[model samples]
Target: MPSPAPSSPLLTAFHDSYHELVRFVARRTGPQSARDLVHDAWIRLAERQRSEGRRPEAPSDERSTPSPQNIAPRAYLYTVADHIAIDHLRRGQRTAQRFDSSGKEDGPAFAASPDVADTHTYRQALAEVENALQQLPARCRDIFLADRIDGASHAELALRHGVSVKTVEREVMRAMDGVEAALHRWRGETAAPRTGRRRALSSLLGLAGLGVSSSALWLGWRQWVPQYQLQLATAKRRLLRQPLPDGSTLTLDADSRAELRYYAARRQVQLLAGSAFFAVARDTERPFTVEASDVQVTVLGTRFEVALEGDAVLVAVDTGRVRVRDGSGGVQTLLAGQMLRLPAGQSAQPQAITAVAPWRDGWLDFQNTPLAEVVERLARYSPHPLRVEADAATLPVLGRVHTTAVSGWLQLLARTLPVSVQPEEAEGGISTLVIRRRS
Candidate 1:
């Protein structure tokens, strides 16, 4: 065989991390097929990179590149490998079904029995479900399959489809309703008007009577049903603290929003915007995870703060420990008093923090942070809209600004930096603060 060409930066990284990538896929698809899936993933990535190179550049083209600064090669490779593994498993399932239908000798045989009619009815129900799925919109049907067949998480589906987790949940529910209605018709059961939310419960009970395994039923419920869900938000200049169902406490900063989802197997909070402080209760069985921007912070029991600051996701650990992973697959472990900042399309590095979420105490701390980002955080608590000019926005700032005394800080800011702070009254009697270069 001819020798392979020298590897590019991405290919080199893949070669170096081949074993680790195999192990990642193995945990999902088993060790036997992990190597093949990882290799296939690399091939797909290489092809994608080539295709991207040939395409015209556009403002919205955020494709992955080999540069370490653009993305974490290992993380991107893992994501590709994980998707390939799912497809591999799905193909295997389809192939097995085909073999069984062909009456292969090695396939399991059904002996003649009095329960044959039940078997026929069960097969018919499955056909009805398939037919119902085909009638759904393409995206809705795919979301349903990804949830039920591939076991993708709601967060994962949301990310993949560029939608919110709530949207994913709605699509899955729509799919289930269609399938259940089809099954009802197949079973000759009269459809009564449902007055309440017992439809899922009734559907599960009906499937149980059709001889679905207890384990399957339990898994289905866990995948599609939520024990409880809560939406938390804070208005401008206001802070709120609320207790979670798991006995943990969540403190939301001004202009922040989060969605709390408690499942039988996990506890998740999607930080939709702004920042939050979590004082978690110890529960080893169900780990707690907070998703912000493209980053995830996971802990068993910890006091931590996650903030979506500008284009970065900031995770600060006040106590205990946290595992933070970004979209590109970069993972960092932070201990008490440590913090990690994941900037968009950049590598993350852990640093020490003197305080976590000082904004909770009415203080905004900046350490060589961009002026624009500082203004953004301040704007959340400001009654008036705040805007920073392009020339002044990039200036580095290092100081603490009291949240309640922002006007005073603005006076000092004008004196310290070559910038002008101007407040203008707009229509609707609202004042807007604009920061511009002094020149």
Candidate 2:
């Protein structure tokens, strides 16, 4: 080893270290990039070795400063290789940027050497396995790709998708289990005697009918009953024309809403929120009723409006007789052209009125009803609030106020009333209908 030059210890150490570094880089970057990264480091090392006025081979004592104590050849080569690999990545990145901007690549920047190409073939093999995984069930395919391709842990993936970590683990295991089971079955079929194998194949062919029958049954079941079911229900103000499954008609007024539910035991619909008009379909077995707050407006067969205004629940029957009942079993019957107002709270006494139902012909009919009360009803469907002074509140109105058209009502109110009904402007999107006496 005297004056070590050709086939020297330091030269062998450097070459071996470079090869190891290439293998490490190959795991992350493709093998072509790995060789480029490793070769660049070696090129720098060779240039340095050649510069030091040394022979055509490695120098014996002419080594770079050792990285650690006792300064070994392996440690020095590893240090040099790491720095050169990083620099090669930076330079390659700049070359890629320049090529992208200019739309030209003069030569291959990361071409694989023969040995590096062999390592890169592993990548192609993994890619083929990836394509095979796509044929698996959706959940199984997702778990396999996340674990193998993206290298995500089961726990990490489970938390990301709001599933249990055990679910993720089980999915991956299931895919591997499938492969093992398939391989075992294939081997069993192959090693069997010809007669036995033929019999097994015939048995499998016969079972194909069962698979077809099961598929047909599955289609039939989907047509009949579903395994998973979901439905959304909410109560909000709606039009009166919505037909009930019980063959009843609903004539709900504006700002009046009801939830219509047809359950198995009984057709139970709780007007859980707003008010509504009901035209009950006669079911002597299951009498239709409108329950609001505490009072239930029971009817034999009728067209009626069940209005909720502050503490008073007003029931105006337009057709058949309605039996107004308190939740405590007290009932009062009111006939058509008759309105009943029941006070909310504990006292369930009902007041029967001779007034007509306002919305019978899409007009607001008032038999000496307060002017302010009529104005209040007008404000509900309007895109504005109606406001009147206290002095104008007690003025009695006997005419019918048609509310079907917004413009028609506006014009009618302006012409008939002593109070001038002029529209007013309000802040943001709010509008106000000003009802003041004419000057």
Candidate 3:
């Protein structure tokens, strides 16, 4: 044979490297595309080598050049082929920049699970709860909400209202109790005709049985029946010791609302909005679960507070261990006093790790908390909009706050800091707070 042309090194090398390059691509791109990608890469390299009119780069060892008897042409061709294939692939990848065509976008998506946490969703939910408040008694609702949503303490509430501490406590408790009962009625529960109340009504009906006015029963449903909507959107409270068939003992905060779904074996409470401190009674037989936004806080014998704030779920373990499961199959175990602030998006890691919760003694503890946050927390109790300018809210503030008189604290806040608090008339109701930079 014509002692193969002296410049045969390139061809030999290409043949040698080809297979290795294909295998490498196969691993990186998976088996399906590996063959095509690698072969394409090899073809492009061959064209480039041909265009340049250069022998494929080859090992510079001539002394050991294989004799014709041991040319091993197949292996040699593959050797050069591998390098050329990989280089071609790299170049093609850079030029093409293949788009991720997996339909699902790269960023966040709305989800019922903890996977998609949207701040807007949480804010909107809170807003919905606010709208539902319209259905509740105004004064009673305000007082009840002032306690939880506002972070008001009994003494502070008493002092602010100029009422004796005892009366303040009584009124707060009464409001909470009434809201609880109101919610029960709303859920369409019938107050069984008590033997006495029934007899009295029966006697009245017997005397005027023929003339029993239709308006009488209409008035009766309004007066005697509880219209608590089971799936109510408003903020409310719940306090109980015994397992309500579903086996959950919840110490619901003031102005917090929840949807109770009692099943044969499972008692599910969807905390649509607001905060609740739950001490789930042990029922080895049934599971006590509370769904707050995207987080499912489940426990059989644990005490924890799950608050739906903005678009985040704030799970704070008060006593015992509680497991908070997020939308993305992420489960976090919270110990006492540990507050986990889980934001939107499926984050295996917590978005914000906070210090000891202050609401243990029914008071909010603050540590290097922002002034704006303080104002926000304070707004819950008062009939005023409290806001923190972006600059001010971000400024680190360290202090302890009572739930009562969050608005009053702002007065003191102005006295202590250079920040100013102003009201926005355009925003209706006291809930809307628009903090602006002071001129």
Best by TM-score: 1
Backbone clashes, each candidate:
0, 0, 38
Better of 1 and 3 by lDDT: 1
Writing each residue's lDDT as its tens digit, candidate 1 over 21-58 gives 76888898776556545544554554444556531111
- At residue 195, candidate 3 shows an lDDT of 23
Pairs that collide in candidate 1 are none
- Give per-residue CA lDDT, model 3, range 165-269, as digits (tens): 556545544553443333334434543432210112112222122222212222332332222224543331222223344345555554567776643345567
Residue runs of model 2 more than 4 Å from their true location after superposition: 1-238, 264-266, 271-275, 326-329, 345-360, 405-420, 436-439
TM-score of each prediction: 0.57, 0.40, 0.42
Sequence-dependent TM-score of model 3: 0.42
| Full candidate order by TM-score, most accurate first | 1, 3, 2
Which residue pairs in candidate 2 collide? none
lDDT assessment of candidate 2? 0.53
Cα lDDT, all candidates: 0.72, 0.53, 0.51
